[model samples]
Target: MGILDGMTPKKLIIWILLAIGIGIVLFILMLYLTLKTKTTSLERITPYKESLKRELVTLRPVHIFELMEPTKSNYTYAMSDTNQYYFQVLESETGADIPLTKLKDSIPAGATIYFEKAVNYTNGVSGSSTPRFFGTISYKEKKYPIEFVWGRYTYKSHPENLRPGFTMDLAPWNNRVDTTIYYLPRGSF
Candidate 1:
């Protein structure tokens, strides 16, 4: 009562309106500043598009079938209790044996390999063949792995079981041909 004694209803209404207007202005200013800061931070973290293009050109393409084979080592029994699998040396299309140690050098950076047929067994019993694609990319003198599969049906299999240091490609949905490359961190193979 004492504080409002000198203020009429009209003055009180004007004061309230002014305070609201000031608050709205301050809020907008704060929002704008926050968004600007986030935008700048994002720009710093993302790679430049041009640099990515230049790096991609360094990769070479190889056929997966040429580098892999249906040997026992390449075969895996899905849905098995023990996750049992065998390891055999992969071979190139020329019938030359490709040692596991030479995989990194055989497929250079930016190289592509097509795995038309992969050996897989369902229920740890019956074998079914699958198709896959593989590639390698190098950035900053370090190689990043890449892989692609023919369909989603085989995508859910244990990718972790893949040899360390290799990358796999993934599709968003089952039966979709489009693929997105996924890179594993070092030692995540």
Candidate 2:
């Protein structure tokens, strides 16, 4: 009698239900409008999602044959013959000759070496540097394009006795190949 003297409980419940229904409809309408505006604005310019689609491919694992020490340095570089990928693994502590036995597989003398730094793609229209292999993967072949990047050592040499000499140390060369491939995606963008 104090709060609902004239109105029945059923009538009060009906009014509350109607208010909830109206609120729900308004919320849905607001959501739709917001989505429409967002989509329209996005259509006016280039979409970032669509602009960056190219990705980096993984570097395949190949055997490195011979390791090279850059002139007047202790850094070491790995070599392969069939594949044109040369890689400098780590800085040499003493800057001496890296033994072939220290490598994951024995790099035989006169074995082919391949090393590549990076893959490059140029934008034809803009003449700009497109994302590509900006790093090196080296192999030993008869002839290779050896571009000397200023202020940077293209190869690195590692210490001998890298955790029990070449038994199951797939971590050294294979891991580096994975890392090099990991950067491939950034090259596209």
Candidate 3:
């Protein structure tokens, strides 16, 4: 009581206002730091999220060629007669027929062919229909099934030549004139 009696009312009011002002400033600074931390954390996670989205949307072509138990040496001679091998190209999603004449010379034996056309995918949607090759390779009066599917990963071996937006040809020929295209089957990552 004795100390309060000496202090003026105006001085007490000023002291109270100054204390409130300091408290307000500290509160605002704390809020700003919290927001900045949250923003930094959001920025850090954005790239990883985008990468995951790309991986989900990106499609890898499926190219599988299984050489039979008894691999035929003279595959070209065996398939000399066009009638021996039945080739049908179909659209994967629609099952529509693609003309065989268009793909005839393009898929030569032992050639790693790349399609001029690029497959476009937008937001996980594929721009072009996948091409499915269904055919039988007959040798010694025995028909062996040879199916080449190009679109999306389904097998363990992912060829380096194959990419998300390109169609790749993996034809293993015994009598290939081109020495550069011949490669032993080693699984790709």
lDDT of 1 at 168: 24
lDDT, residue 42, model 3? 15
- Tens digits of lDDT, candidate 3, 1-189: 686787889998998999999999999987655443110111122211222211111122222233222112222111111211112222121232632222222122332222112111222122222322333443233343333332332223455655333223322321222112211111111
In model 1, which runs have C-alpha deviations exceeding 4 angstroms? 35-37, 40-189
> lDDT of each prediction vs. the true structure?
0.31, 0.31, 0.30
Better model by lDDT: candidate 2 vs candidate 3: 2
Q: Candidate 3: where are CA atoms >4 Å away?
A: 1-3, 38-189
Candidate 2 or 3, higher TM-score? Answer: 3
- Runs in model 2 with CA error above 4 Å? 1-3, 37-189
Best by TM-score: 1
TM-score of each: 0.22, 0.20, 0.21
> Mind giving the per-residue lDDT tens digits that candidate 2 earns over 12-92?
999899999999999998765544311011111221122122332223443332234442132233322223322342223
